[model samples]
Target chain A: MATLKQVAAHAEVSVQTVSNALNAPHRLRADTLERVNRSIELLNYRPNRNARSLRTSAVELIGYCVPNWPHQTHLVMDQFLHALCAAAERTGRHILLFTAPPGVDGMPTYDDLHARRMVDGFVLSQTETHDPRHGWLKDEGIPFVSFGRVWKESTQPGPWVDVDGATGSAIAVRHLYDTGRRRIAFLGWPKSSGLAEDRVAGWRTACKELGLPTNGMAVRCREDSIEEGALATARLLDSGRDLDGIVALSDVLALGALRELTARGIVPGRDVGVVGYDDSPLAEVVSPGLTSLRQPMDRIAEELITILTGDQQPAERLLLPELVIRGSSAPG
Target chain B: MATLKQVAAHAEVSVQTVSNALNAPHRLRADTLERVNRSIELLNYRPNRNARSLRTSAVELIGYCVPNWPHQTHLVMDQFLHALCAAAERTGRHILLFTAPPGVDGMPTYDDLHARRMVDGFVLSQTETHDPRHGWLKDEGIPFVSFGRVWKESTQPGPWVDVDGATGSAIAVRHLYDTGRRRIAFLGWPKSSGLAEDRVAGWRTACKELGLPTNGMAVRCREDSIEEGALATARLLDSGRDLDGIVALSDVLALGALRELTARGIVPGRDVGVVGYDDSPLAEVVSPGLTSLRQPMDRIAEELITILTGDQQPAERLLLPELVIRGSSAPG
Candidate 1:
């Protein structure tokens, strides 16, 4: 690691002359260029400086760091990530992917990425109330954006975009009520996730606001899986609760409920009614079909990019989740 | 931008001296370093480079470029990507993310990063038959590794680590036959993707090898969505085809197939056995569960990282997808 100045001193020239000879040779005498080049070779120097210092820049890559995914093999997230990868290409940004498995106390080695400067700003998904990644990025001064909001505060930190989970759930519940269903049930994930919590709150609030039951059969979900949904449905039925309508937080759970109902000789539209969220393209494929709320995928994708690139500021952009009415909850 | 050499010349020093002043000042004579620094300030010359280059030498950046993964959203690559990222960190390396979008064709703008030099090598994913990125990267003469192999012969082509799709499919078919399922149907993506094509080929080969019938009731699905799977199942049933057993390319599709069977008053595991690939968390979530093949995500991830870091130069690594027996394929 000999210094370029040492070489310059050895060559009996000022540093400016050395810089001119090495970087802007045309502005320097040919002999000066030759001497400076020889000095650089002698020093065995490699320009390991950050690319930002350069006048011309490269948009050769982009990156995403999803740490709070529900699970590794989750079917829904799997599909979203795939779409993101494809979408990244459109922006001339490639996804540098990273995962931080939760450790004890629900914290992972997120600082490792920040310390080493892994990728250019990251695309963070599944924001929580007090996400550590947000503060860590600020301390490390790394650029990043989120797929969901990190806090419930009025003046939130960071640029983030998210699917309208609350609105979707509210719409589902509203639809069920409209179909003359008084006792509606909400099925889906445990109330641990921020998104799930939002959906749950919306369900309960809608019921209370609409003068419907706020507890008991109003919410009968125990978990996120299809089996759990089915098992929960069976429990609701066995408990002799008067539930006539159902709104699941997710299509997968809704599907499980449907299976349980069908097995019990219950027809979705006639005997009981159901509505699913995510519209998951699966709603249309299911028999009797399913009424669902479709997420605004393109808008989320676009907003995420804009924020990550510093092209957009922190703003609450909520796109309406479309209510798709299929056979399952067609007001029959 | 004012060139470093111009600064050096203006400051009356060799370019090496100027570089030493900015990049390695401590190694130069204090007086000389001061002179170079003063000259740089006077000339205001800057180098064009990726922001990452400015970090310490021994650049450990290993970029991974993907060709838009729209279909991958459901696959939840978090576990795999996280493992790879963790491995890279252990070996003192970083992963760069890059994606190619719809309108953008050929290589992304790499003027600053590639030309000015940002990363040491790359880790490419979703390699196509004749990947344009491959040719362009090859021309740049950058050392790289791949999670998938590019088509055609290349001079000093990078190493690849991919799942053995053909083997997995064949095993699935054989398992069905072993279970006394002679009229088993195949359900999966169209024969386009190299991996998908391999699975189809393997299914056919396995059928032929086992002397089993390959016609009728077998479904060729266009997508791996659960809804698509259900629709395909409905199609087969509507056609009145005799399908004793079914193999879906993905867990989502298999779940859909199970739903269709339920709708038609058919017991999934008892009446007609069903199997799925991907072993998604959803597989275990569904009632009667699902018999599926599981890809070794962690192993593939580790292999990709090791190869990219030059710890190993594997020509191509093939991982076996194991069959996870579940309730869906259990005979009553």
Candidate 2:
């Protein structure tokens, strides 16, 4: 409920100055803009949403559709969403997270938003291998972009953007090799998620190039959950695989793998080096401070909104993931 | 693409019978209903969402207002959101992750739907201490149920529903006290969050009731993160307070606290009794699995939606949480 006037008081500026920084950004000096912004955040100022929205028949609402179809999707990219949200505001758009179980048998369904024109367009998550949603959106000509491309997508046209999973996974395996871990093991996704599958493929390719023995070096899970990942790791070890380095396909699985290793009295960075993907905050907090492939969620989000808003074109943008060497994969 | 004919084929029933069983439930026998339901799940059948929603103007969109209004949030609970999304599908509502940033600054903002009338209502998350969102929604008569209720709003007429945080925290602390740990430390969230503050209050009240000393019992958050929690735990131990039990406000924090305890060569649940909030999947994956509080998101969602669409007066609702005892806080 903090107002522009309050923000102005904190920034030692006039109401108009505060107003310009918010509405007419180009009108203010750069330093003044910075000060005004700092004051607003400091005050927890929310310009009356309803009233501001009333001014524009188009309320800066950006709709996100993360289909909770077939298997449930948790949508853990807060780092991505949070960053994209900040970028969307820069474009004067607000985000509305939209997901629904497709009723009937359970296909992905959108509530009245799609049918009633509730959104200007959508930023969808987890583009299916053969996405019906993509075709439907194309047929309807609704403005939208996928967080990833569908299997059939040629050149990933039509406002879609993504973090290249194939490249990221390869980078993870390559890092393990670089860190003096020759016998690398991949604990990967078992199911049919395009991204997960891509990571697995990347790992296989990395192993093939490195000339590492692929036999019994791979662990799979029906899902990328911590339980599935942990259980899979345990199962793989119990199955008696000789592995020196482990590169998990996801942060969750990495955490799970970390636990499994811990239970067996294995030191992560020493006994069996570990590396995770997604670089979720959990990766940073685990005991060994997990080494991970950092997905530039902010960069992807930046490009996603840019493409969706027509400021940029639909391009298969690959943001290079940097390997954060933490204690889990810290050189012993 | 899967139709009633396909469902009938899978279930070995005629299309007419399948239709009768699904739409005309009263016309079907009890055995038929059970078979159809079982077949529906077995086939992973999701009735084409558009077809089912084609009749209702409801657009079927469920808005999730992900609180990104210039504040820190916990991470583990996000995994639960995936589960909740799955649960919502069972009930036929899609979840839209919504975030209203704080205006141009980083306060709070909502969707254009707030004005354009695009969405049915909202599932507001991170209820503040004195949330004006509740008041505004009430004034506008917009349907919304909070994921967690605003602090100081127990008596207000509400369409809000949430897990009983106080009760959950009390359960964890009482368990600790029963196990003969009197000097307990609470780690977690900032004082701003009504929910976190409530957890701290619950810990304090429980400690006083058990006639334990208040010296070592304190709620502190250097930062609202697991790394923060770990660092805080380290600092707390270093500060030379006689601490026997620790109740972390979140699973991520508890994980961090566990790491901190172990780094000091202290065994969690043995040398120190540790309890965590949010029995996230990681709670089970960690070695010496974390004993944590479970929030009933499904219950929260069900009650909220029932109030939103159901013919019920606006009233507050609270769902009791479960204390899942695991290895992290195994009773001695």
Candidate 3:
């Protein structure tokens, strides 16, 4: 049961060199590899280090629960999953995907997989303030990293990497303001969602700094969908808010607003600037192209995998989203 | 090393009774469970059955190469992946996702995962004729099932479950024909792709059966994208083909056609009937809901898992795509 450092000491080499001797022998001289192997045998390290080596020889697996929202568009999650797979592969790990039984959350499956050692750790997404999985996994002393904030009230914290939604909205507001837009309205989802509220905060801060009227300039939708967005836009227009720009929290809502504007013969970009978030494929495909904020999904995935695999205490990373200007946000 | 059947015989119980004793003990009577355990010890069946039970106790994993087509919209694959994950979970398996190195295909990663015993089998998609992975996996004596056909010219074939693209096109054609559209045109990709050709075949067959002119009715695009589809639609129109309906091979192409028609002040349903394949979210979100063919992804995933886990020989399943009628194909 000798530690890797002890094996390194016995072999008269660095700990990294001992690891290279076992995992990447080509990186070491023949004599060094021989010395490390000799030390490993003499110290009876097979029980600990050899077993670990055998496990490492195969691909390590990280479990992810595939969210089943059939009616919802999954462009963001789809992009993130692809990026996560690429990031995990770079570190010799793979993503093992599971789904809960119909109408159930993924806790039971997570428990079963953890109990049986099917995964080294987990990568979570779509987490909320009171997600039971966070507390449950923490209580079980399991390793996990979420793509979004855990938002839990606990003495201990979980690792996470999230996009700066507030900053994304702030950037959108500033861009719209700089483009001759004095009155910018925010189209956002219900405030019950932490993620949605974060975006709204950005809009509020940016509007107040720009000395623009904030009263009656923001509209909340029941959900993030095209229909809801259109309905909210209709309310903004009918209320005589005299808005010249609209910054929607998601592309779906933005597209909905565009649909309403087009129906009323009001040209987007020319008459009323419109911007959305996520920069999904729909953004580019939509006519006049959608001005959107693009989250750094690849970088976030890389960070998540790093935190999940590295033997470090939990880390929190908040990355800024980049505003991608398109025809919809073109200055008049 | 005694088998489960032998253990059942020794315990004077049904095979299900013995299995329940090990896996679902609550389903068995206390005395029956005791008898099964006693028989297992008496016959020294622990070596074989215990190992098998232990292996099954942990979730079996099916390897999937996460296709990294960043620009392409992945509605179909995204839906299929969710379905596959759900289906795998129902049968006590999971999907292990790996991505190939940037700019590389997935063969190397697949071989690595298979060599390490990290997965029980594979589920492939985006497969093409003469796909090297099929031949390579066959040579390696690995188990795999493709969501698409492996059109390799080999005696030993791979198991696959594919949606009938030809039938999908035929259904579109027939639907368009029945909807008072006398002249139906086909917008499809170049002939090099086996899948595109299959779809074209359906259009051709249906066009001929309905005694419609096949010549000069089909237009081929270099790729299946919105832009290419628009260009192809333009070509079809400028050629004076007098087509009143268009059936696109994919939703992207169909959306492109819609964009072109809308730009030219031509209404979709009234001026030119349109239908698309893959019934993606775009089909619903598009201005005029697109009438498209919906692939039975859930059923296909179920069949693929059944073939992969069962000891049966390779099976080929060709499920039909259902045409979902919507605004784009409404009768005028």
Candidate 4:
């Protein structure tokens, strides 16, 4: 709270001298600069960056709307958020968080924040088909970037960075096949979800290409929960598909499969291989550590930041995920 | 990005009339106001609250310093942040997040944000004994509220809201006792942690009141991890302590204890009761769902907002956590 004049008086220097000591230290004698700095420390004076930002019209705050994903474990969003924060911090920016009101998908909050000029731009996540926010942001001419790609082609083009869920599923299938499990099944979400459909496509392509049986080897669930996953797994097992491997679209589903397998007294790694997506921390702690696909969250975050800040044309990036093999998918 | 003039031109009204339509609708005829509003919507004109705040000196932003706690599961922090965001939303404010540089406390960021007037006040978390940020904020005369109480008596009194960890642990003890467990043991953290110490005090108090033997019934770990927890549990079991019940300070630690018990063919809930804190989503997902203490994060968040925005004197509150019963501590 100390003023420049107070600091100058404390250091026995003119106000111009103190200002020079702070702004252009090379213009002042080394001793004078040191004295002014000492006075600043003594009085705990801090430079006002916000005032400078106001002049430059750069708040250095990125808006992020927290989505209410109806899932039991929010591990994916939590980790992605942390990575995004670290990415933003590296660029001397901070995240301004707000939630959409009930039954709305982030439009009102985004419009208010952008209109107020409280944020330089925004970083969007959980993009879906026909997302109204995309068209709205484009119409408003607000600078923004998304962590998930816009699924519909009719929407205006925008910068986005996303993980390739299809490739992730293929990689899991290949890992299971290489481990000598030819009968591979998939536990996936309903077809309405584009991302989950993409994952299922990868499973079918891989199964046919590898000369494996593909009929009745997949189960689709309506919700992404362990209970639903377990029920799906039960239907798969009861159908007598002779499946020896299962690749879940999410870690939660894989955990449910593991629970079902344990209850049935089936050794996971030895009798049937299991793999999960999104190598959540639970994957490592669970019994017979789950094999999972690890999304490049940090890289995706960095790319989103770059797209938001860069002065180039609109961009799109699809990054690959790494397959982390654990005991659940290990060859016995 | 539409200007007020553009909206006024489209509505065929003067700039003052447009402003009046937005600010004082009664001043204009209903038809005139409706015409102006339609023009505003068509042009997507939004009022500049940031510029207005310069005059009002109310930014409607509360600064929060994100701590880099080295833990695998961040469920507690994640849930608390969501609750805070929800609470802030109710009050028409938002949370601005910043991280402290490595090896330093939050003082530098707090000072910068406060000095710049980018934030009206701050919400502090993860407080420790002799935290320098507390003293610095007080010295700078900044309004702030803490989610954890300052431990040192010499530190200046400030508004804070915290969970009574001792009471949480006592509740866990009472639950275990009511389930017909007598020799209840505690899995805790190192003595240096004040919160963990409070939990230990509660366990001791409740055990002594119940006339249960307390000697050799506590296992202390250095970190809040499943590995450390399992090791502590192993030590307790190896020491012949006859502990039929275990109370862990965190869900991760209790999970490790569960793994240890399961490996030894000791069924949890049936033989050895187990309880964990911070009723994370994992508590319900894990097989034989974990019994844990659920902190009232929403209430705490509401209390924090009240303290930061209240017109009353600085007040401190310690809320009691609720015990959520589950299969992990069910009576067999």
Candidate 5:
């Protein structure tokens, strides 16, 4: 809390001299700079960067406002955040995490943070259709990049980096097909979510391309939780539709399907090839080692930071996810 | 980025009137305040909280510096951070996450962050013996509270909220014992970590209380990764030790142990009961649903924020971790 005046008094120098010693040592003599630094060290004086940045207009902090959903733990979001932090550090930037105030309107907090210069820009995640944040940031001319894309019809979506969910789902289905499974069922969330719709579209496209029946092969879950997945799979099974393979929209749902298979005395990889998306660490540690689609998290994060800080161009990137073969989707 | 002067000019008022409208609305007449507010909204002017805070000395941010270890993902830490963010919001505070610079001297970033008034205080996790952060924060007279405790021998440990790992281990051991497992072996990390040592101590204490052999029953792994855990378990099995139950220091290690057991044609719950720590989301989804100790993350994070923002007293809290029994450790 020691001010420049205190440091200056301690070093027997003027306030401007102390400031020069901290910011521009070239303007001061070596002896005077050293003396002022020694005084600063002694007094633990810390120059306020917020005040200084008003003139310099440089902020080393990147803001990420995470939605605080009380009931659910966003596992993929957690991994993305970890990767983003690591990527930011490699680029000599820091990520500042804050929870947006809850309610229908959270854009004001974003506006306030930017206006106060608490962050240089933001990394928006889990963007949805007609997302107010996208329009707001674009209108305000704030530097920001989203982890997911806005609606396709929107003319000004701004810069964004998103995983190719449809391609990921197609890859999962293709892997299951290559493993000699003809009947592939797609388990996914409701059609309201744009991301889920894209994934389902992938499944439908892959099934059509492979000449497999699409009707009665797709089922919807209320949520991506394990219990919902299990229930949805159970319902699919009870419908008596022949199913030899399953491609879940998420690893959570796939794990649930595996559990359901076990309860029915069905061998997972042998009787029914199962594939999950998002090759989280859990994918490898499970009993059958879930075959999953690995989103290029590192690349996505790197690209987001690159575009956000590099140029003002409105760029959009959709990175492909690679398929990871594990025990669950391998042929018996 | 519009300044107060622009709003004043637009509102046909003096700068003092604009300032009063923002900070002290009671000083202005109702009509004047309404007119100033309308002009402010029309111009999209935002007051800089950081500069205002320079005068008031009130900060609404809490700092949490995470280590970005690229090779190994800190799954429990991710969950803890989610819980921490939620808890902080209930108390009207935000968490700012930054990565500590690599190497032995990461304290400078912490010092700089505090000195620059970027954060009001910090919440330290995974504290170790002779942690420089402890001394640095205390020396600077900065506010901070640790999520885990420091070394017992330290004279001036600060406020901390930690789960009793020893009690958690004891609970796991007792559960295995009750399920008719006589010979129990512990799989733990190398003896450098105080938290791991506490867990091992609990295993030993439980063994003594149950009249089970403690000597030569504990084994150490190089790291907490699944591969290292499997290698350590294989080594333990190869040593010709009679082990019927295994208490792993972490779920990753325990899952690895299960894999090794399966490879050896040993059924997990029926033949050898396994218990892991930090019952992460992975615990329930894996085959046989790992029975592990669940740390009270919500309470720990809540207490940390409460203590950090409420008072400067060096308060310490130790909460008990509950054992979540699942199919992995069920009686045969």
Candidate 6:
């Protein structure tokens, strides 16, 4: 309840003397230390733990920054955070979450937090091709590991763990093809996103190998949201394309597609099969549970912590996603 | 990257002299201050923001503690966090997230963070009747606001913002009754949670007011997960209780009930009307979109931030929940 200033006033000493008495008693005179201790006991002052930790360099904190977008539902990222916390605990570390100030071109708050030593390192998520965090962190020689990777041409090798999106998408396409679905469509975000491009490329590769048409079957949205997915699916349906199967880049999109299909009197599993990425919990509850690709969130979290804590080498680790077959993609 | 110790070593002074030079130059000799500044510039030593803030007593950080339960999908909590972050930003404050050490009876980590002054205060979530956090924080005189409330009899209210769970349930029950449903079943968690009891009380009150039987329709589960919900629904159906309506305590349970009903060839809206709480985004995607109670998360967040930032009185504020009607509860 009492602050160091209050204790200092009560003891008739400088605030520094009171702080030193609590954190580094050897630096204070014996009489001064005794007087400070007496005042602390009288005022019931709880020594600020952060101040003591700062003096001794014992702040074992790791930070992760989430974008300040209120409308977005980060279901997969939430799961990843939960796993990351567990992994950090295993290493006797704690996680500190901060929001990325919106509209900032580069992460300035990250530099501030680093300079202040508020955290030992950061666990960067959603890394992009030209991510400014990569250059800033590397130049400052700050210890950090990303949940994603930089551009292929950047040649900036760093510690990262990401899901193999291409493999995940290819598995979805193969499953649909095996189920006798010929007219499969790919729904993804607009070009320039590395992850989305990887997913679309896998769909194209599968179509080429199986002699299925790829032209006019791929569509893009400005964002990865359920509303966008619904709008995209509506546009596809209105475009007069006869699609038998649909592979969505994310589960949110797949859910939107299912909603649109149901609104148009089309049963998802029977009339038009639907498969989604990121086997979120919602995937199971939907009628005719969605077939989806499950990212190894736990493994990714473990890998990130291992690299950040100096337990493993700094290398990019790409884990394969597992396809979970539900009723949504069952053969009619 | 240079620490205060490194700066002190380079300047031929003590660590306290380097700290004083950055934070309280008047307290140090002119020669000492000049030497420390020169060494700082030479070593490119950035003064730790946290340490400087500590000296000036200006750390505008509020903390929130999340449980480290991986098996639980905190869908509602995630939305609440997003809203809380936005609300905090409106007041020029930032949120710092920490995890409650698993298996620990009391929040020792919270005590440590507070002692170290890592945050100004905390925004506590999931306040239980016998919550250890309540006693510890209250005894320590820590400034915090709970997202939930303690038991009705405790009478030790400090600050809290919670939804009227009883009113939400009553609204659900009244809606079902008005829809000409007589046999309305209540599904909830096993006793011990005050919030859950409040919800079940609403159901009982509605049943008593309408002269309907309440003894055989109430059911309990060990957890609030979807799998448990499905098992409970299956058990209820197997009992042949002739229930025509259901009000689940949560959307997860309601979703599970829908899955079980569809599996048994019992249409939800046409045969057995279903209503869930917490109108999660997933509620709209499920077939026969679920009728649910929408908790005003944004308002709650706003109230919490207002209380935490000393802009409002420390009193309990209970917001009303809105009932969102959908196809799941439509009349046959």
TM-scores of the candidates in the order shown: 0.70, 0.61, 0.76, 0.74, 0.65, 0.63
Q: Write the per-residue lDDT of candidate 3 for residues B221-321, one digit (tens) a residue.
A: 87666778888898988888887899999888898888778767789998889999999887887767899999988899999999998884868889999
What's the lDDT of the predicted structure labeled candidate 6?
Answer: 0.79
Kindly give the number of clashing pairs for every candidate: 55, 30, 0, 0, 0, 4
* Candidate 5 whole-model C-alpha lDDT, 0 to 1: 0.80
Error of 3 at B106 (Å): 3.8
Q: What's the CA error at residue A159 for candidate 4, in Å?
A: 3.7
lDDT of 2 at A27: 56
Q: Which candidate achieves the best DockQ against the true structure?
A: 3
DockQ of every model listed?
0.24, 0.10, 0.26, 0.16, 0.16, 0.13
Instruction: Give residue A317's lDDT in candidate 5 (0 to 100).
Output: 91
**Number of the top-ranking candidate, with TM-score as the measure:** 3
lDDT per residue as tens, model 2, B176-272: 9888787888886777677887788888888788887666456577565667777888888888887788999888888888877876778888888
Model 6: per-residue lDDT, tens digit, A27-76? 57899899999999999998666564664353466878765455556666
Better of 1 and 4 by DockQ: 1
Q: For residues A127-155, what per-residue lDDT tens digits would candidate 1 score against the true structure?
A: 66677666556554556777776655565
Q: Best candidate per lDDT, number?
A: 3
What does candidate 1's lDDT look like per residue over B287-332, in tens digits? 7889999877778767777776665443678789889998888753
Cα deviation at A15, candidate 3, in Å, is: 39
lDDT of 4 by residue, A244-314 (tens): 89999998889788767766778888888999999987787676889999999889989998889888367
- Candidate 2 has a TM-score of 0.61
Better of 1 and 3 by DockQ: 3
What docking tier does model 3 reach? Answer: acceptable
Supply candidate 4's per-residue lDDT for A49: 52
Model 3 DockQ vs. reference:
0.26
The lDDT values for all models are: 0.68, 0.70, 0.81, 0.81, 0.80, 0.79
Q: Summarize candidate 4's per-residue lDDT along B100-201 as a digit string, tens digits.
A: 753345566776666555577899887877666666676667789889876655544677899999999999999999999999999998888778889999
